[model samples]
Target: MKTGIIGAMHEEILLLKKDIQRLKTEQFGSREFHSGTIDGKEVVMALSGWGKVAAASTATTLINHYQVDQLVFIGLAGSIQAQLHIGDIVVANQLIQHDVDLSRLEHFPEVKSPFWKDFSFKVLPQSEDKALQAVETFLANLKKGDYPAISKEYAPQVHLGAIGTGDQFIASKDGKMRINERFPQILCTEMEGAAIAQVGADYQIPCTVIRVISDKADEQAHDAFAEFLFENISNISVEIAKLIL
Candidate 1:
């Protein structure tokens, strides 16, 4: 079975690409896709860019051109829940496009943007199981000193919950409050997961979304974001990929 692994940035997928044996690279939709075996598992990896449209297009291309049977997306997200701090991992059980609003339409006043039934996608059970297992394994390795500690006092915790997706990068306190009020169960906010999930749903390909908390969705969200990406997120992603693959 071929698995299509997607990340929204180069740092997220760089180490996984290096792990691929007998790698082959190709370009499609202005994105580079690398195909090879990781731990005897056939996989295709790519950067899906940074928004719903880009993610959907890349996912569609992977499903259509590469014939990937399943999809996995890993990236950094701004935490919406106060309990979730940076370095914590969130395995998305469901995802919603929080920015979608059809509630204003005269005929569709009953359709509530994020609350609408069609606006959400549930992760496939089997795929979620695999992802959870991989995360648990990674955490175990961390405890065994195979990976670096998340912090002096904090061991990264895994949370399974709803993740909100949208085009906007939530950076202000008001933005976080609005989304939290709208979707209280949402653990984190990011740009791409739900869109790819929608495409996966369309093609009947199972999808799994795993995100690492990079910043709190607040006024200071962008501060040190780039440093966090390079210093921490990439290595965590590599460990997860190793277990998942």
Candidate 2:
């Protein structure tokens, strides 16, 4: 089966693009898709850009055009939880849009969305149990000898929980705290995961996101991003994909 891989930033998918064999490029609406095979699994890789619109648009194309059986996204996120540190992995069990306020629209859908845009029409998106299990399997056998970062006694942890997405970047302690209050289960915040999850849901495709924490989402967020934005955290996503495939 073909799998579509998307990353919000160039660095997120660069290594995977380099690893693809028999690559072919195709463009639609200015977005380019790199289609090929990753260790024998048919794959399509693309930069979905930042925010909800870009991610949703890219996801629609991948599902409709490539006929992919599943979708996977990997990108960087800022930590909302104090316990989370740089280089930690967050495997999304569910995704919601922290910025979408639909309290007023409750009568519209008559159902409920952890985010906006749904109730009667749609609901939040989630990774399949098997998807989480596959990722956990990969993590279980991981060795610190190869991944020196995790080799340390206080190595970063691989957490699985809800991920919150919004178009706006969270860079203040207050903003981070507010979201934490709203979505008490949120592990990380980023720009695109929820949108992709929604699109996958609309098309009945399974979706999964693997995020690496690169910042604290605090006043120092700007500095933290500048320091680690291009450090290729997307490698974690690719490794997870390789194991699952």
Candidate 3:
């Protein structure tokens, strides 16, 4: 089966590209596609850049142009829950757009657009059971020698839960705490997963997100992100690709 992989930043995609043998390059609507293989699994991959629109457009291209059967979004996220630390993995069971707000019309919390009323979108209707199971299975069965490149004593902890996606980078402690309080079910927050999830749902294609916790919601987050992400992202990507493929 053909699988499409998308990363939100150039740094996230660079290592994966190094391992893959680039077979061809194609362009669709100003976006470039790189066809390749990862761990002997035939795949097409690209960096979707930073936010919702870019992610959605890339997902659409992966489905319509690349003709991939499944899509996997692998990247980093900020830990919303206090217990989660840098390097933990979060497999999204559901995705929420924290920025999607329309509480002005004497109504309960629900999605709304300026032009439309009561329009809401729910991501991952079934809670991504198969993908979550795969992640759990992989984590449970991983061997120390399986990946020597990563120095962590144990395989990363994989939590199956809600992942909030929005356009803003979650660098503020107050904002992070507020979101956690409002959406107690959420474990992590990132920029692109939900948008891609929405597009995948629209096209009826299976999609899953695997996010590595890069920082906790605190002042240390800003200080530690660059070094933490550079060291962990590639390793995280390899593990997620193994589970998905």
Candidate 4:
């Protein structure tokens, strides 16, 4: 069972590539893909680049070229929920492109587009049952311990809920508030999860999205993200990868 693990940034993909024993590399679409074994499981990992289109294209390539049986996206996201804070982890149960509004986008005439032909602004579904079960097991079976990058006071929590995606980074207060009102159950917001989910839906590929909270989706998000860009972000992601994959 070959798994395709994707990340949007170098930090997100580097450790996994390093962890792969007897790794081999191949370049595709200007991105390098590393293939090897992870915890005795055959896997291919790559940096999918940023945004919805890049993620979708990467997913398609992994499916077609690597023929990966399952897909996993591990990265950081901005927390939009009131209770969530830094170092918190979120296993996406659902994903939606909050920026997608077929009604509003379809009305544009000058710069014509066809991608929104029959699409709707609804929750993009993902095949995540087994992945969700694995996460539940991980949380339930955990022993008392402190996470390295996580603060003891915050006592990092695990959230399972919807993840919103869009090209624009959620920073301004109004941007964060609007998304919150649109998707009340959102656990976090990111740039690529929904697009990856959409490609999975097309190929019937099972997908699991895991995001660590890096900042609150507000005016200070960009600054906070810079201050808190944990160097070991890939560590938590790989830990979850081992358990789920």
Candidate 5:
């Protein structure tokens, strides 16, 4: 099976690009596509940049242009739940667009505005229990020693829960607290996961988002990102590859 991997930032895609051997590069809609093998599995990958529009367009292109059977969005997110710390991994069991509103429509009560009456979004069901179990099992066996080139402990604690997506970058403590109070079950917040999920659902392709916590919704988020990203991003990418490949 051919799998497509999408990451929204250069940092998230760097390791995957480096790991690609026998790569063939192509472009469609100004986006670069790298097709290659990782762990003997056929893969096509791209960095979709930030935000909902960018993510949705890239996902569509991946499906139409590359003909991938499945997609995995891997990246970093800020923790909305206070207990979630940096380096923890979150596999979105479901995703929501906290910013979408269209309450005026009776049939789509989830939305809250007349303008958004025709803007209902899509949702990808959580991958089957066996797939999730396999991911968790691989994460459990990941070790820092296994990746000698990488520094810091590569321990990952996986949380399966709601992940909220929006176009805005979440760095405020007050905003984080407010969102947490409103969606208490949400585990993380990011800019692109839900958008990708919507496109995957439209195409009837299985999709899953695996994110590593790079911040905890505070000023320290900026201070900690460089360290957290450098130490854990590649390890997380490798873990995702192992699970699917």
Candidate 6:
């Protein structure tokens, strides 16, 4: 099966690009698409840029142009749940767009919104199962000696839950509270996961999102995300991909 891998930022996919063998690169809508095999598994990789529109566009292009069978997204997120801290992994079983509330416009009578009923998109059950198992295998055999020194500080724990996506980077406690109040089940927040998941649903393609916690979604979130991005976090994606691919 051919898999299309997307990352929210260049750093999120940097190591992945290097791992692809016999890579063929091309430009689509000004974004580079790398087609190759990762450990003999057919794959295509691309940076999905930063927000809903960019991610959805990239996802649609990957589905229509590359004709990839399954999609896997790897990125960083801000933790909404107090128990979740930096380096923790979240495998999204479902995704929703927190920024898409249209209930206020219900009085328009002609306004149709998916959020009015149910906005969450479930990851394909079969693909979600495979991803969860892969994460388990990755975690079970992980050794500090096998990774960077920074990894020694915390052993990453996997959490399977719903993730909220929006164009805004949640940097305040009040913003976090408002989201949690509406989507009480959201484990983390990011800029692109749900948009890509929606595209997958539209195209009938299986999609899986894996996020590593980089911030607490609080006042200091910006600094946290920046620091975590420069660390050895990308290695986590590489190890998980090996098991999944």
Best by TM-score: 6
Q: Write the per-residue lDDT of candidate 4 for residues 103-200, one digit (tens) a residue.
A: 67546766566444432222224446656666555555443343455333433587878888999898877888898887787778999988988887
Clashes of 6: 0
lDDT of 5 by residue, 186-214 (tens): 88889898888777777888777777899
Question: How far is 96's C-alpha from truth in model 4 (Å)?
Answer: 0.5
Q: How accurate is candidate 4 locally (lDDT)?
A: 0.78
Q: How displaced is residue 186 in candidate 1, in Å? A: 0.7
Which pairs clash inside model 2?
111-119
Clash totals for all candidate models = 0, 1, 0, 1, 8, 0
Worst 10 residues of 1 by lDDT: 146-155
Q: What stretches of model 4 exceed 4 Å from their correct place?
A: 104-129, 133-154
Residue 198 C-alpha lDDT in model 1: 93
lDDT of 6 at 45: 89
Clashing pairs in 5: 101-112, 101-113, 102-111, 102-112, 102-113, 103-111, 103-112, 103-113
lDDT of candidate 6 over 35-57, digit per residue (tens): 99987999998888999999999
lDDT of 1: 0.88
Report the alpha-carbon TM-score of model 6 versus the true structure. 0.94
Lowest lDDT sum, 10 consecutive residues, model 6, at 141-150
Better of 1 and 2 by lDDT: 1
